[model samples]
Target chain A: MTRRWFLHPHAQVFLSVLLSAASQVLFKKSAPMSADASPFGFAAMSSGWAWLAALATIGSLLAWLYALRFVPLGVAYNLSGALHVIVPLSCWIFLGEKIVAQRWLGIALVLAGVLVTAQSAAKIEETIEKEIEEKP
Target chain B: MSPFAFALIFASIALQVGGQVFFKLAMNQTHAGRTARYVPALAAGVAAMTLSIMLWIGLMSKFPLSQLYPYEGIERVMIVASAALFLREKMTPRLLLGVALICGGLILVTAS
Candidate 1:
């Protein structure tokens, strides 16, 4: 029962976003701001955390592609907005990062926008399918 | 931020959007049984994604993550717009409102 749920396409989308947030946090941790941290340099590649971050990124991309097979790009893409919330929260909890009240408000707005976008995407997809069926 | 910084941000987002669109196109082609076209589409998608990562890494190295992340919201908006344009995805008024709210929120986050 548990295994099947993990294989669900929507579940994959959720997993992808979670992994993406994880990767971002890991990357941020591995690459501290420094004079040698040039734009094109690979200095961070020396860190074990950086490699794990890369692996997470690759895993997220693969999960995303698998989900895309079943979900419309529009819907799946909008759902990814959850990253805005997840990444910030992860940083706060795991890294002892501080988010200001204003940023928290902004995060709330982003969550609302994600819900709105998701609702519209699903409705539009249904209408499009109906239109195609009615055409001929 | 400098104009050049803005340009780099724009470029990174565009490349990522291009990557996603290509991947969707590849999937659509597969479903349509145009399998021969799939390889090129997938290849293009990978190339675009790789370039976007390189650019993103460069941006991350230059700027703080807090300052850089708001641009991710902007990237989502761009991706949705491109999906409508390239993938024949229809955009509704509600979708537009949602995207607007997201952009506004990101702007606020940046301000904060």
Candidate 2:
């Protein structure tokens, strides 16, 4: 797999992953801070941590947009799948959350899956580029 | 628990997938203001996502988070399928494997 895409600022996929995962964790941690989390809970909406989570979400969204400009939607989506593991693992470590054994196994599977996906993405991109060249 | 709620969940998934696809289409545009295509796609995407959020809120009121969480895993699979079909993106065996693993992992994680 080429490291070029990883280093490219325009790709931003890696950065998107980090920011999105952070947003998930922040949103989870801040959920309890909201006294009432109903559809129209004005007090819950104004919580400081909720606002922080919202900011993180906005950052993640912008990073996603930036990344999409460079990468295919499929590859970008697959790369971000690692957040399934990251958010929970970070929560277990930082938030003192309890994770059962099965969940750990699942997380392991996800990490392996993401590695394979990342490798596949470069190969696919090369093929697509080749196709584009051959056609024109 | 009813068919209608499940339908709402499915609609939400469709909307989310639609929004992502349109956003991709929007960004594929070369010019900022001139391309009439991207703007419509962008507007539709945002509108779909906004409606999706409302559906999700409705779903949350009816079902437990754990019950509804599996749909997010379902979403991972759908978006890949979506890219393949609508965006004409290539999908490989490893990519499919990755999707399965991630979905499985998401299910196991949320089940806990």
Clash pairs (backbone) in predicted model 2: none
Model 1 residue A31 lDDT score: 79
The per-model DockQ list reads: 0.52, 0.41
Cα lDDT for residue A44, candidate 1: 76
Q: Where does model 1 exceed 4 Å of error?
A: A1-3, A121-136
Candidate 2 DockQ, CA atoms:
0.41
Which candidate gets the maximum DockQ versus the true structure? 1
For residues B2-112, write the lDDT of model 2, one tens digit per residue: 786678889999998998898888876623445676778878877887677556644544454435656878888889989999999888888899888888877787667
Native contacts kept (model 1): 0.47
Residue-level lDDT of model 2, residues A3-84, one tens digit each, is: 3445342356667777766755554554443323464223334557556766776677777765665577877887888777
Task: State every prediction's TM-score relative to the real structure.
Answer: 0.87, 0.77
Q: Chain B TM-score, candidate 1? A: 0.85
Note the Cα lDDT for every prediction shown. 0.79, 0.70
CAPRI verdict on model 1?
medium
